[model samples]
Target: MGKDAPYVLVVGAGAVGTYFAARLWQAGARLAMLCRSDYEAVCKHGSFDIKSPHGDFKFIPEAIIKNPSECPVPPDFIIVSTKALPEIDVASLIRPAVHPKTSIVLLQNGIGFDEPLAAAFPGNELISGMTYIGVTRTAPGRIEHIDSGRVALGKFPRGISQNAQLLAGLFAKSSVPCEIHENILAKRWEKLVWNVPFNPISVLSRADTSAIMAHPASRELSRSLMEEVCSIAAVAGFPLQPGIVQKNLDYTAAMKPYKTSMLVDFENKRPMEIEAILGNPLRVAESHGLSVPNMRAIYALIQLLETGCRH
Candidate 1:
């Protein structure tokens, strides 16, 4: 890793991965992206076409490999933007590209998903990340950056690290606002206030976020779910700010008509991240002797939907 440019390997060329990798490349980071579905498209086009709020641009990676083993060398940082699906073996997925000094930045969603990866590679640095951007992979090698594009990152337990700061700086250079939070877990919980309500409700109701929030009954349900998550987070010692529920509502209401990641997964017949997004939180709340009926009900409903898909 040079002082001016860090070698970054971006795994999962999905919406989040492509958005961040394009930004990093624009910021002058030497990047290698491992893409699956759009490998040939990216190779043929020689760049990724990104339609963003900041600006429209094309990003060509230093190396585009279909497999981790194809990378020239171990990267300074490996940014994983893969879905936090329970069945995915993330350790095996990124094993070939990991080196002793490689920092693993999980730009992923949900709680407790990092534990297995941390356990798999105890020698590497693990940075937990959460992105507030509205991005979607519209097609192969094409992305639509719908709304905000900011990120919050922190080390596993807490506090900021040099690697975390470096990644934040890279994002900042690319015009993406990146904040280093002292408590990453608290940040994850705060994100859940938005994700819990919008992600699942969108899928369950088969409606966009705007529609869900526009209706009074569904709007109240979203607020109730957010309050329940806040209560659980408070009991777990990461109390969120007052009016956070309204803040989330206002933010969602202002956003464009968009389907959440979970909703998109459902629409595409891909497995939704039920366990990571909802199951883990429910488990934690239960262990803390708290009852989250709203979350539990949503979880049950989503589980039924998932079970139907599986069958």
Candidate 2:
């Protein structure tokens, strides 16, 4: 990632985007960010924070672009790290940045976004990835990593493939731990094992990772939700490991205290990313002729709380 290296485009400068961009820049990649106008502060100050397990440090990228068209050359790679609410609009807007060889890496949460995002750029290379980095946004240009910094990424074993190893190697040199996953879907669903329960529950209950993990009822509720998804995942062929729920809860218990992005949105009276995080899973289950009762309950509660906040 030097002067002659590929110019990697990182879309979304929120928590996940900033965290990876910081690392990508640090690895000597010439990075470009498709950021919102609000993050002009980040562009000007050239100062951003990343709190990782190894340590926390402030970082600045090489260049930041507000508009996709500002980037003259088509990016060799694009990482979509936005909350799902903005992804569809952003995907349609940035179609020109992708050439036949451009690789699209999705870092968003949930299982259902892959196909649609991939379909956006018909022939461009698409690689789906899951980031297990636990991060919270304290402010614009600010992010705190509460727990893990693991990245699972690779080509879709089930479909048309692309430059899988090259991108994996590039990421491995970044700050977080990166692994080339053959079963990328299972990796994504495993991360969902943590998110489907924690995100919505935290938002509705106004609890951080520690709080949701500590309550006996909350712990039970988390397990039940995970089991529901696990059942559906089995039919889809990603048989998740047993005890993953308790393991994620334990992982949360030992981490820095933080509210999730969904919780942050709830508190700020902003729309939650419920459709991708919760609604999508429920939709996927039904498409497969399956029922996910606990997930249904959580989705209902999320709807209610979202209404409560707006009203």
Candidate 3:
């Protein structure tokens, strides 16, 4: 990897990882992806097919390795797009690919998700990335980009770095909107205003986002949940803008009928990110002496669902 073109190791090749990896590869970056399930197919096919609103194309990563040990060289940046499940050891997952100068960019959801990783790998740069894209892996080595592909990148805690700017440029070259946010935590909380409600509701109710928003009762419940999250954010010193609740509702209502990631996981009988998405936020709220009844109820219900799935 040269200074002109950095080597990027994408840790997960699921929907979000595949989309971003394809775009980065297309933007002239040398990229390798750690794909467990799709390794055989991606290697044989030499690329993944992507169907997106921007354009349909095939992207072949520089290398598709099943394990980090197979990486020929330490990457300048390690992009982690995996599910933020509690059981997954993220530090161990990226250990082989991390170099002294590596910048770890987390593209997963939820608040307070970066602390453990940051503590594990001290001195290396940590970036917080929040994505607002609707994408799904329809099959092995195949992705369907439904709508809206925008990313918000920022340094952990606060401020922007050259690496973040470079990443934004890479995404921009592929026509993906990537912006730098000084307060990425605030942005994460803002995203929770949408994720906290839609994700779990879709799972429990067995419905898509459009259907959830269409039902009067569910829609009202979603609003209450959003209000609760906003209150927590406010007490935590990251007050969201006024009208964020309505804006999120309107956005989801206008979107195409789509299944939340949690719903997809539940249907596939896979582990959902209940802890990172719900557990951490609830912990923050409790520490701040704030109560979030709606979030607590949904968290409990999802915990039960997850318990059954794991057993």
Candidate 4:
């Protein structure tokens, strides 16, 4: 729109990417999206038909590229919102569009996952991001956003920077709540407090949030898992709030019955983020000589579940 408008290239234009891309667009940034599965549909439709409680709108990006190398220009920011599956080498995927000053933003899930990206681009600023939202791509070029869509982000390892603040301001202008944090890793661990319990449990039990909360046995199991995660976080030096487990339970219990992303991936026969969500934290626990038997059991069961489903 202007000579000074920031250029943002979104690497994975899935539901999460599209939603936030739309926000950035609303804040007047120029956008180019590197899309895959929905490329044909999005190209044919000429827009992303986003249906959200916040608002419903259609977004047409400046360019729809099939590869990062096809990016029209080097971007000031590259937002990588891909699933944290081990097989996807995210660092290499966005390398082509990265300029010397490009701020690489990791808008993804899980714990301790930013290390690889930080390692890959030591010179570039790495913004660690965590999004809390209930969203999905119901079909090609279509998104359904049903619940909270807040985000917390900061420079990787620690502290907030100008890039982080600028992006947060853009999201805020678009009316999406975005917080800049001093230590985003702690926030990731905080999110894992919920993800650890609900995500895997949803897949293992074939239950949504409400059903999981309603059942006495499942509820207790979830509580135990949360406690284990809190313990692990504490031992690892990022001690969580005093009543995180119960606080998470209360919030989820009151939430709309919703299928987790992991469950949705399982039903669709896609690879779940088992390693990133469960395995990585478990490894951290082990490094600190902490025992998280509940997480270990759930992690094992989910891994087996994923294996059986894939075959």
Query: Best TM-score goes to which candidate?
Result: 4
**Estimated TM-score for each candidate:** 0.93, 0.87, 0.94, 0.96
lDDT of 4 at 11: 84
lDDT of 2 by residue, 135-242 (tens): 777877778877767777777544425455665556677756777777788887787887888889998788998888789998889888888878877877888898
lDDT of each: 0.90, 0.77, 0.90, 0.91
Model 4 alpha-carbon drift over 4 Å, by segment: none
* Global Cα lDDT for candidate 4: 0.91
Model 3 lDDT at residue 137: 96
State, as a TM-score between 0 and 1, how close model 3 is to the true structure.
Answer: 0.94
* lDDT tens digits by residue: candidate 3, 1-311: 24468889999899999999899888888889899998898889989999998889998777889999898778889999998988889899899878899999999899877889889888899998988888989989999998888999999877899999999999999888998999988999999999999999999999999999999999999999999999999998999999999999998999889888889889999888888788999998999988889899999999998898789
Sort by TM-score, top down from the best: 4, 3, 1, 2
Residue-level lDDT for 4 in candidate 3? 66
C-alpha RMSD between model 3 and the true structure: 1.7
- Give Cα distance to truth, residue 160, candidate 3, Å: 0.3
Residue 82, candidate 3: C-alpha displacement in angstroms: 0.4
Off by over 4 Å in 1: 1-4, 254-257
Query: Residue pairs in steric clash, candidate 2?
Result: none
